[model samples]
Target: MNVNKNLLNFLKSQPTSYFAGFNRGIEKEALRIHASGKLATSQHPKGLGSALTHDYITTDYAESLVEFITPVEQNAQTSIQQLLDLHKFAYQNQGEELLWPMSMPCFVGSEDDIEIAKYGTSNIGKMKTLYRQGLKNRYGSYMQAISGVHFNFSFPDSFWQAWASSQGKVANQSSIDEGYLAILRNLKRNLWLLAYLFGASPALCSSFLNGKSTPYPMQKIGKGTLYLPYATALRLSDLGYTNKAQAALNIRYNQLDDYIAGLRHAIRMPSADFASISAKPGDYQQLNQNVLQIENEYYSPVRPKRVTESGEKPTDALERAGIQYIELRALDIDPFNPAGMSVEQVRFLDLLITWCALTDSPDIEREDESIIAENLQQVILYGRKPDLLLEKNSKPIALTQWSTQILAELDDLAKIFDGDTQGVYHQALMAQQAKIENPDLTPSGKIMSHLLEHNLDNGSFGLQLAKQYRNESFERDFHHFTQTQLEQESKDSELRQQSIENADELDFDTFLTQYFGSSLSD
Candidate 1:
């Protein structure tokens, strides 16, 4: 792949004012654990606000798996501060419970012991819980508990306008959506680079493989830990949150309509396997017998997103307003960072994502999709291996050589990004370059080293880190939001959730019918 010099030059010609207003939001997930290193069997913390209606706090998959969300901000620094404040508020409210610091889960007991997240008595609330139950039935609860970070990003309208002008085209929603889809395609093709650079979950508790055949060769760290020596992110491997049923879907993203059509087809199409689970009125094990319960369930490395209106589905929202932003889902929780990500990491992402958007992105054929997956899998499993190779257009490429090329391109982008303080972007790029040269500097490598040095199992090592974070969180002052504001938000969210419950006019089945009906019509 070669750099698209024309696109790069066009972007470079834009004034620095065009670079303003890069919006970002973060959703960071962490499991709540007990002092004994067991998964916490606790309710959602009261202080953090309602899990369903809160803007900044929620639960994912399980009640104990806490997810902190940040409101969209123009810069990474403010976004990170919001995340830290959320952590502070959550820590204060969660008594005797610590947030598990890694993407891989800590010690888990029997599958039955893991509790599903509960919402109040509204029909929609019941629907949320039932969907999770369905997920538990489809994929085990342990896999659902594996946590990660989602980075939501979008370039400013000014930048898009500049881009359109450069192309001698009108700046319209359709063109913007087309450009974003192109960026999505490019990101999907090159996501393996990110996996190798930032992946942190190379090791996991031995119990994660319980009652199943091991997927790959594993080395024992202690009595209760298993790890791959060169693995970058086991959390992204077949071992975590993977659905074999989805693998056969062959979804495409070259265009918005095609993408929406594929999603609609899957949701409307019935699945015999899920049908067997049951969908009776009171015995609703899942949302429907369809391949997807909701649009959110479709797992992908990246997704185009738009904020939905009242009673609008995610797909409907996208169709209405085009892509407002793209969410990157492949980032693992940075165990070393208290907030799961850093401002420097955010800057690096901004550069890479902008590069992806500005570069030439050809439509990916069905056959080539498998090649992309293979490349990602190779990096996830053996990224640290010096001799490891990755596939580019079905041809072998040295991992280091390809990475060097990317970094060199990034150097040019960095200069364009921060000509005033050239050191800022270059510093981040060099830090990543250091990680490429020295695998020990990588998060997974550091995790492995810590485990070995302390002579602790994965569970023990994670627990220690969680305890350390707990103390640090307590010591740190709130950065962006105050405790009073958090408390008020919690109360307000409770009232909002009740209001939603009160406003429900249709029966659950009737609501589902209307929902899928509108989706299919589109």
Candidate 2:
């Protein structure tokens, strides 16, 4: 695979300067489990701070499923260290409750056992809860309890400006937005590569199947474990967070305006399926009868985002100000890492995303969109299969052959980053290559081996890992933030939530109308 000459030249021109200031934030979700390895039914721990307003810690779908968010940082090491600090803080406050270590839940009893996360009396709080309620109604609570990690990333303005200048274009928001969208489109087309290399959730508890029949041949490993021998990242598959309604959505990432329009249309168009459920404020099963209650409900492998102002919806923020960052939502929690992710993984992402941005990307046609989806589904379900093939440019290509080509390109990009440092980027590239050569080296492969070696089900293996992580978290020192700082942030977040609740002036209906109203700037 020949490297893009223009991209290489541009990087070579700024050997020490490129990608030095890129920003990144991490959001890691984990289900809280009891000492007995059952899902915890307890409310959000008070010591963790307000779920509605906490900047660092909050509940994702269930009250027992905690999401630890880190502030944006310029370096991967710093961002990862901050996340570790958050885990340490959460472990301290969680008492006997342990954070489930894997992407899949430990031991769920019944659908009703998963408690919806609660916010206080604020209308906004109620709205958040209702959204989760809708998800539970649409997709089961078991699926919602499946936790993962989100990586939010953005190139620095200086880097964008330089790239625009090289392309004989002005370094403005429009150009930057276009560049980001192109990267996103290319990322979508090649996301299967990421899944093949990093996908971790190969096997899950049989409870996850929920008595529904699946087409895949599932072998029972232990008491209740169901798995495909070569499957990788089942969490990214339909078995994870999925919606039948979203499968019909033909959203495209080739253009920013079209992307926003697609989301806006989904939120406004009423869904016959969701319409059956009541939308009355207190009786609301969902936020509304629309295909999407809010823009956030649209599940995608990637999303372009801008930090929103007070009372501004996500779409409104993106329209008012162009894209500020991109969020990669397909990453599964690495059961091997107590922090749910590794700095090496973050470094690999930086290289891949940067490559996406620099490479020339053609606009995806409507027909090709289906191909992209198909390719992704193939990798998610059967990526590690020895003889698996994937469609690239509407032609069949062996998965290994395609992956090998992409990795070779990444190897070139990594050298640019490994300029003076300790070859971190190159090492990450080689590590990924090793996974392609040896399937057992992948996280999902390791998980399967662990299950077979221990003679345990997926749930049992995950529970033991959770216990191990909990012990490790308790013993780890605070790397980035102090306990005092975390405690203060908790208090401050609670106060902030109180202020929002006190300032509520509109009825719930009015607030929803304004939020979903026709106020999109562009």
Candidate 3:
């Protein structure tokens, strides 16, 4: 009868069968293209979007891999294991080529293959390689795949504050959007700890442009630059809506336009909050630039928000207001694995989210941008390293201890899920702890170890990719797979358009204005 009781009841009543883990299946079509030496590449100066569409959306690549290879129901498990299977199948069957979009021209294989310049390595290295190659060949980029799974629980609207307070403190704002924003912000902050969770290759490269010899710090982002793939994680909020239907509707009915107006209306005096007012678009751009310039000039290290050319407008500003979900950009589509992810890993991640939801620490604040940046950098560069410092209770604490505690909380959450054994999350946490004990399992260590083991001079990652390109099954399977997917896309698009038509026929605007007193974001 009480709010908290009702909320818990709602959460309990809802099905817990939501997609919790991801499994990717690679289509034979992608493999066939890789097997042939004619994979496409991108050489775009501004960005790679014009160069590679497939590389932009890894989901398409994953779907292609699973085509005809597995039955529809069996393949659609929405678990990380599926993603791994697809990648393993592609790598084993298809020939590996260092193509554009999926990879960058880096020294990847054995230490012996060091003839090539080792520049441009990001979490996005594989994707960049595929795109770059796709540009040159005019065929298509090699694909990196991804599958996403969400563990969602909802409460009745009235009990949001009770739920928030249960986690420790009430939010500054008690609205649904504010609650979502708080959760998302916490997720983003925690993800900064990814490099510590699962190691990535080390950052070892001279200047990307000049190839000048310099000792670069072993951080996610080095001097004058940060990894763009990491940057992409921040951009996840740009898409605006929760689902494709809502996103499409917003785009169609100019819902965002009205929303923007509503926000402006709510701001009683914009001039009071800011230094100046701007009627012209150019003025607004300049004002944004000025803010960023000031922040960079005064601050020692910034989290690298978007920048613009002298004439270009600030495109990523709206996202700062907070209507986005956290995107996991650090995870790569492992070329060696068939599924893009593992079930254990997904379960572990779910546990992490649950911990975030249940933990009652008011450590994060929107105003504390500086601390957020510092925390993110610390995690990416020195995550899980015993010596690295993390701020807790406004004092420095060893990262290892913090991680251990956080992971312990996750272990408890896994018990609450009752889906898999507790061992699943605990194993990963222990493995990570062991790395802190040993320090060799870090991303940098893995990169170096891979090169040494292969006995190659250079291009260890690149060479591994090249091996995947030439697999026989890849060639045969991918060709058929992509064709089928393209056809499927056409059908889906047609169906989507029909749904749009049906929705459009209704007077949603009138219904909302009369019944709800506000227009939906689309």
Candidate 1 displacement at residue 193 in angstroms: 1.2
Per-residue alpha-carbon lDDT of candidate 3 for residues 36-130, written as tens digits (9 for 90 to 100): 32322212212111112222112223222122122212123343333333333334422333221121223212222111111132212222332
Worst 10 residues of 2 by lDDT: 1-10
TM-score of each: 0.97, 0.96, 0.50
Name the 10 consecutive residues with the lowest summed lDDT in model 1. Answer: 513-522
Clashes, model 3: 96
TM-score of 2: 0.96
lDDT of 3 at 258: 38
Error of 1 at 325 (Å): 0.5
Tens-place lDDT digits, model 1, residues 297-380:
898879999999976888888888899999999999998888899888998998898888777788988888889889899989
Q: Over the full model, what C-alpha lDDT does candidate 1 score relative to the true structure?
A: 0.85
Return the number of clashes found in candidate 1. Answer: 0
Please report how far candidate 2 places residue 309 from its true position, in Å.
0.5
